[model samples]
Target chain A: MSESRGPGRRPGRRPGVSDTRGQILTAARTIFAEKGFDKATIRGIARAAGVDPALVHHYFDTKEGVFIAAMRVPFDPAVIVPLLLNGPREEMGERLVRFILTVTADPQAREPVLALIRTAVTNEQAVAMIREFMTDALLGRAAAALGIPMLRMEAAFAQMFGMLMARYILRLEPMASADPEELIALVAPAIQRYVAP
Target chain B: MSESRGPGRRPGRRPGVSDTRGQILTAARTIFAEKGFDKATIRGIARAAGVDPALVHHYFDTKEGVFIAAMRVPFDPAVIVPLLLNGPREEMGERLVRFILTVTADPQAREPVLALIRTAVTNEQAVAMIREFMTDALLGRAAAALGIPMLRMEAAFAQMFGMLMARYILRLEPMASADPEELIALVAPAIQRYVAP
Candidate 1:
């Protein structure tokens, strides 16, 4: 149970610190896949990876962090939560819309998120994993931070989520081709009502 | 090509009227998949089905109707467009939300639409086909009927589209578990802005 050794650990087989990170991620994926987001624990992941629990905390800091890293999510809540909170309450909608559109504007950045969504739609386990993660990690955190009701925040998120599908996945125009500013102007007030109301 | 016979038709092998309808649907699917919604014409589908273009029109009055039949869409725009137009303009948002949620509430009704969406997210041809059909037959028609910009209507549709994904596909709660009326209240006003503004 030591940081250096566990039942699954073999002597003289440690590649390095980076390898430890890889092993933890590998174990995290398995644990997350098997138990989903809510039930998967850092201690469990660490045990599965043959490392101590402290090392899991040391590497990822939190379960949300571990999920984000493991999933290669395009946006970080650590960065995004502050971005939403630091801005003026009135402008939060515009900021949120712009931020999402900007991040997803890049094909490379958008693909993995789209892949997750694609998986979530067809696969029940993926849905559970993603739903729990988004509810707890992203929307729950932001709703609490903004002092908004979780349902209202989710409504706003759902609107944005749909827009992303229309614009990117379905490529429905003028949504797909409209300038980001135009979308912000059209969608911001609606989002602001949920977040700031 | 005649209604009774064409190059692909075999002599003394006609099944029945229902078989012809099935043949048209099958051919429409192939034509739509190959040429997309915009390019796949009644003539093309009829030619592929080994029937007269008049027979295609007689069976399914328009390309949109054919698409709906071929795809087994849960809702029809012929019914939906009038529903949007006939209502009090201010309440169009509520009507739209209620209708969508209600129709999709049935697992039997919802699955094919979800399957199309699932196909759409990953498949370029599906996206193009759905996009054109939606833009031309559904949103475009509704927008013109209501004197709203097509872009605005599309944005509204996107909001609802995202909510459906959140509610059903992702089953994100309380979005998934919340009362339908609660969602209609939270979302209707946002939809009204784009739709009735």
Candidate 2:
């Protein structure tokens, strides 16, 4: 949809919808960097983007949504949370392991996630952003939905996170070169214990 | 022990044992960085340090030992493998988790390990160095000693590695703040499965 343009229609006077969305994302990145995830508000991001707060909400439903968009994460919790919950409880671990490994198997999709992880390791601001988003939007929601303890969920996440580091970043073999099915078989049972009600 | 000082010896002529040890570590770091863990050799490191290869062997029993010294890893496989194997088979997981968390709890001891992990994520050479060292020195030894498959050992390590990332780097709460004993309770069983004969 196009924004109404005044008669003058100067190139800079009236921005398009995409332009506003881009502006919001850019502002979100800067604000997230400066203030981190906890302190960065939608209002502040909208103000920085020169847009109304309502517009920011229209584009991204919540702060977590905004962060995910700004970070260009390949998968969305909106999508992933349901996937985790929809499966039979016993198979949750297998699904989680398979989904993560399969999604990250593609280098193009994995780069942004890996980059964010690398940044989180070195930068406190990045860590804050990642921590809040992961806890609130991802792990918290999954744990609450499944009625599992938050600690268990975090532990499960940690296990998968480590496996990814081993497979992709560290390239530790057998883990690195093993077929996806093999890893799912080896790791799923352990993950099952973490998520079982 | 003091080295003999020949007549007309200058301050630089006869280095103390600690100084020579430091020189070897310095050279090991450079060589490992340049050639990665696999290509780097003890002879090459000794030659770079202007010492005999035999001296390098005398000081560091193996190339992995040189890497451990150069990296300032808080724990050594020489100590850890035995610990893992000496324990009751079922309790190995608990011991492993407790040991890792306890050692890394000290910020002073954890920094170098975390720094290495941070470096490994972004740098190809660092990844190679970590991969070879971990596969050969740590996981290989433990898997062989326990008579378990290498894949199982690597997976177990991956779980712990990821937990460390969550606790220390990501600082994801619950996992980050949970009592070490509590974690041992939750995680030990999964680890037991991996290491069990």
Best by DockQ: 2
Candidate 2's C-alpha runs over 4 A off are A1-67, A70-72, B1-72
State TM-scores per candidate: 0.68, 0.69
True contacts kept of each: 0.77, 0.85
- lDDT of each candidate versus the true structure: 0.78, 0.78
lDDT of 1 at B52: 88
The CA lDDT at A182 in model 2 is 90
The residue-by-residue lDDT of candidate 1 on A105-177, one tens digit each, is 8764565466566656655655777787788888898889998888898899888988888888788888899
lDDT of 1 by residue, B25-56 (tens): 76776666445455578998888887789999
What does the lDDT read for residue B34 in candidate 1? 49
**Per-residue lDDT for B167 in model 1?**
85
Task: Give the least accurate 10-residue stretch of model 2 chain B, judged by summed lDDT.
Answer: B1-10
**Tens digits of per-residue lDDT for model 2, A66-92:** 877876654577777788889687889
Could you give candidate 2's per-residue lDDT for residues B1-197 as a string of tens digits?
12323223454766667778877776776676555455678999887777789999999999877877877555578878888878587789988988888888876456556656765765575678777778998889889989988999999998898898898889898888999999999988888888883
Which pairs of residues have clashing backbones in candidate 1?
Answer: A162-B162
